[model samples]
Target: MFHTDCPAREVVDHVTSRWGVWVLISLRSNDLRFYELRESIRGISEKMLAQTLRALVQDGLVWRQVEPTTPPQVTYGLTEFGREVGESLAELFDRITQRLSPRDAG
Candidate 1:
């Protein structure tokens, strides 16, 4: 797993990137349009969000669907594999946040 040449390294990097995990977790529950996703994840800039979504889509962790409409709406959601990954990441996130809560910080 630690080998530099390992293919999983790229996937791991994408999955655990600064915004990757958050993106995955955000789309886990429901499909969301670009603006909705940006709103859901506070403090993320438009450029950063676009880059993150593009990476996730390329990795097959997120599915992007474009609707034929006046403005051509685009939505993002997690794939089956992505859902599994998101579930695991969500659990990890919960544990970390719980441990770092004010009550636990003596």
Candidate 2:
């Protein structure tokens, strides 16, 4: 790990990336398999979903567990560090929604 005074930019890339934010939020609800995550996150293509997961996995923010079943299953969930990011993002979402709740009428 390269030493840095602050890694805010790297954190932003992991948290605010198109799929990164969503994937983190989705995992906050519960652990989900690869396809399950894809389905839970609507409007996202499989390729993008796979790509995002790979990035998160590499960052050590998302944990991937494989279950040996007949066909095998893989689940993704947030690591402890990821949970903090998820909570922060969730609060931001709530604030945005509260602020935009009304005033769309003529």
lDDT of 2 by residue, 1-106 (tens): 3456557666667678888888998899899998989988888999998888887888778899989897889999999988988899888877777777477321
How accurate locally is residue 18 in candidate 2, as Cα lDDT from 0 to 100?
85
Give the best candidate by TM-score: 1
lDDT scores of the candidates, listed in order: 0.92, 0.84
Candidate 1: which stretches are off by over 4 Å? Answer: 102-106
TM-score: model 2 vs. ground truth: 0.82
- Angstrom error at residue 1, model 2: 15
Candidate 2, residue 90: the lDDT equals 81
Most lDDT-accurate candidate: 1
Q: Give the clashing residue pairs of candidate 1, or none.
A: none
Q: Candidate 1: what lDDT?
A: 0.92
